[model samples]
Target: MSYETYAELKQLVLPHLQPIGTNYREAISGEQKLVLTLRCLATGSSFASMTVPFHMSNTSIARHVLATCEVLWKVLQPTEMPIPNEDKWKSLAKRFGDLWDYPFAIGSLDGKHVALVNPMNSESLFYNYKGYPSIVLLALSDADSCFTLVDCGQYGRVSDAGVFQASRISQLLDQERLIIPDESFMVSTTEKRIPFQVVGDEAFPLKKNLMKPYAARTLDTIKRIYNYRHCRARRPVECTFGILAKKFEIFQRPMRLQPDRAITVTNACTILHNFIRRRDGHMIDRTSEINYEIRPNNEQGLMNLRPQQGGRNSDEATEIRDLIAAFFNDPRGSVMWQDQNVFRNVLLLED
Candidate 1:
């Protein structure tokens, strides 16, 4: 973060972080507290590791870090990650169409596992399929690679679909309380209107407003094109995760704090991510840290290889998927380079 950005953030949270001085000794200033918290987040240093440098005891460092993190979330979340209204959702959809060429996509969804030390007496509840104790950080990111919404601290054992099912956004979606825009026609197509949706990987169920790629083995050229376009549109969330992990080194290793505190730390990092992005502009160069290749062998046999964990898809969802696939193959909705990209290896196969 730049000095200007840090100064602005410090000003916003200073009121909440200020400490009262006593006759015995001067209290730590808010500036010092903020610096201590940022150092821990940026370096993932243990509280004990911070003690000698800050000239404070480990307990004092931990207390101040936790307190400052809580304040950062409280102060920053309202502005940095505000709840999206219907107009905001529409704006996001427009951005996706313009940038990624996927119409009516309001956001891209994914889950990231933050490693954790097992909480006492919790058994294997936190242990995940990857053989680590973790907490899931499920996020919805906009086309600009900024997080629009996030749910932190889910047990790592649950699948991405399971975590989404239990999320508050899922409840809002079910109750029709979220202000998502109504169904609208796709660009260059007048056949039928489709609901605004979020794109995710196979772990998510196909819902009226959520899309996953079709099963890999069953895909033909048209479906492969759909998956290709779908993955392109979904790349921002992956990029956002990469940027977050790179910027906040705390995520590189398992957090030593308890589950609740770990959640606080995660939330703080996400809020700060938005804060920095808004100030520093989008990090377009960092997208290369993640692979963008869509190899034919991998696309045909390996991607979406895992059996989708969520239950049966509704007929409406199936129709939506088919309609999208058809659109991608049609002249009106097709891209110029898609055919060449999808079939670039055909001669090798023929040989």
Candidate 2:
């Protein structure tokens, strides 16, 4: 982060992080606390390692880092990452249509596994299929690679679909309280209107407002086109994850703190990611060379769950997918290079 950005953040959280001094000794300044926390997050160093440079004991460093992380989340979340309402949802959908050529997409959704030291007595509760303890970081990101909503600290044992199913957004969606814009035609010429939607990978269940690509084994030209375009639209969230991991090296290794503190630290990192982006403008040039698809060793099995059994998608959802696929295949909606791009891959796969 730039000095100007850091100063701005320090000002925002200073009131909450400020400490009271006693007659016995002077309290640590909020600026110092913020610096300490940022250093820890940036390097992923152990609290003991921070003591030599910061001139504090290991316990004091840990306490300040945790407290500052909590304060950062409390202060930054409202301003940096507010929940999107109807108009905001529409704005996101418009960006997706304009930038990615996928009409009516509000966001791209995904899950990431943050490695953690096993909590005492938790047994397999925190243990995931990847053979380690972790907490899930489920996120929904916008077209500009900014997080729109996040649910942290889910048990790693859960699948991406399960984590999403249990999120507050899912509850609001099910209860019809999410305030999505009304359905509209994909283009002026299309007869059927479709609901605004979020795109995810195959681990997610298909719904009227949530789309996943067609089964890879069953791909034809049109389905392949739809999948290709859908992947394009869905790339933002993946990019955001890559940028987050790159910015906060804390996520590069298993966090040594307990689950709750780890969650707080994760939350703080996400808020800061948006705060920095909003201040620094789009990071496309810096992030373009990043391999967004790379996963940490702990996250290799994040979405390995089999497709949900015995649960059929509603016909309406199927119809929406088909309509969108047809739209992509139609000249009015098709991009010129999509056929060339998809067919080359098809030929390679056949070989």
Candidate 3:
């Protein structure tokens, strides 16, 4: 986290985080408590690990961290993830097109596994495919790498699509009550048009308003180009996770707290991550992140749980993806250097 961000967060939560008594022997000062919490978050250290340096017992350290996190979550979640008006959706689309070369994209969708110990008596509930106990932190981030929506604390055993199907955000999108704009944008200077949409990897199901890349190892030129553009558009969410783990460090190591406490810690860090990105525009480039790989296609089969919808929705989704792919090849819809850049990179890889 940036120094300015740390200072701002500390200033906002300090008063609420303070103990009531004026007596030093009775309780620690707000400044000391805040410092202790920040240290744990920055280093992902256990409470017992912090006892020697902070001179506080492990119990006190845990208390301070959880209490501070609760206060921050209540104060910041509303402002950071407020429902978007029509103008806000349009603004997001404009930013996506201008910055990411993907027109009509509202945000990038992805999930990260935050490692933790297995919960007691829960048989394989939190165990992910990678043979680890964890929780999934799913988020939709805009072009600036700020989280527009976050749904954390889902079972790590579930795939990204399953997590989304179970999330309240999916309910909102399904009901068309998410305050999305109704306006359509031109995908081509001609008659081709599309509604603003979110882009994700093939882990997510395709919908009229949500896009995923074509799922195949063998791809034609246009499909590969479309996949390239779609992947680039989805990079921000991955970068957001990278930046969060890099700054908080807790995500780099398995969490030792109870499941509930682990949720609180992850939630607090998420809000703080957005706050810093909104305040300082800090985004880590993640092009070279070796651990970041697409989730296996077999793992993301989550449509059975979704509500039965009319076939028109599926048809429209295919039509939308086709229009976008055609738009990517059109002179008016295409970026001048996009084809050359993609081709050059492909050649470099082949060598």
Candidate 4:
């Protein structure tokens, strides 16, 4: 929060966190508690380390951080990461189209592993394929890079698709409980309709409401163009994760908290990230952030291809993808630069 906004927020949350008094001794002030919690989050200091400055026991520091985080989430969740209604979903899609030129895109989805020190007696559960002990922080971010929905504490070992499949939001999406509009939008001048959907990497399975890039092996111009556009649309979520990790240094290093506490801290950081984005306006577009993993030649498949699970129904996905490819190839929906940028060297190679 900015210096100007801190007092206002502190006042709003003070009533809930204020300690009850019995005339025996004065309790810690809410401002002090908030400061300590913010300090720990900003610095990723261990409870023991924070005790020195706060003049409190390690246990007290931990308790204060967890309790304050719960309160922050409870009060801030409705505004920060409220469930998307039809109008809001449409707004998100509209923004995606305006900024990224991808129509009917709801939001971008991705997962990142927050490193953790091994917990007592349960080491194997947190061990990930990257050969580290951590927990997954799967999130869906909007066009402006604010987190719309987040699910933390999934086992680090789980693949992006697995973490998504087991998430509560997945259950909601599968049962159509989110009420994501049954609406479709025109992707072409001829009125080819494509459903509004969230885009993810190849790790996520394709559904009517979710889209992923086409594999990069083919030489077809249409598929390559579609893949390039889809990858661009998915960049926001990756940028969100990048900004979140950069802002919260804890994610850059292994956290020494227990699994449950780690979840609380992770959720707290995510909530605070949105808080800063909303109040402080620290949203920066990192679209040009250099990623060595994705070279310009085959940038379409930058999002790694994990084993696709739980789908034998990619027929509709394939059809929609083909339609999008056709749209990009058409003169109406085609950007002027795409023809040269996408097919520049390919045509030379063909010749």
Each candidate: RMSD? 7.6, 8.4, 7.8, 7.6
Q: In model 1, what is the error at residue 265, expressed in angstroms? A: 0.2
TM-score of each candidate structure, all chains considered together: 0.90, 0.90, 0.87, 0.88
Q: Pick the winner on TM-score between candidates 1 and 3.
A: 1
Ten contiguous residues minimizing lDDT sum, candidate 2: 286-295
* Candidate-wise lDDT, in order: 0.83, 0.83, 0.79, 0.77
Please tell me which model should have the higher lDDT, number 1 or number 3.
Answer: 1
The candidate 1 region of ten consecutive residues with least summed lDDT is 286-295
Q: By TM-score, how accurate is candidate 1?
A: 0.90
How do the residues 1-351 of candidate 4 rate in per-residue lDDT, one tens digit apiece?
688667766866788898866788788888888898888887777789877888999988888888998887887788888999988987787677767777667899889898988877876888999898988988888888889889898998899889999997788877778767765654334344566778989898877677888777764778888887888888888888887887777777899888898898889888888878777775444322111110122222212223234656356666666776776677766676776777766745543
Error of 4 at 159 (Å): 0.9
**What are the per-residue Cα lDDT tens digits for candidate 2 across 168-212?**
767776666877765454343345555678899999889878899
- The residue pairs found clashing in candidate 1 are none
TM-score of 2: 0.90
Name the lDDT of candidate 4. 0.77
What order do candidates take by lDDT, descending? 1, 2, 3, 4
Clash totals for all models, in order? 0, 0, 0, 0
Among all candidates shown, the one with the greatest lDDT: 1
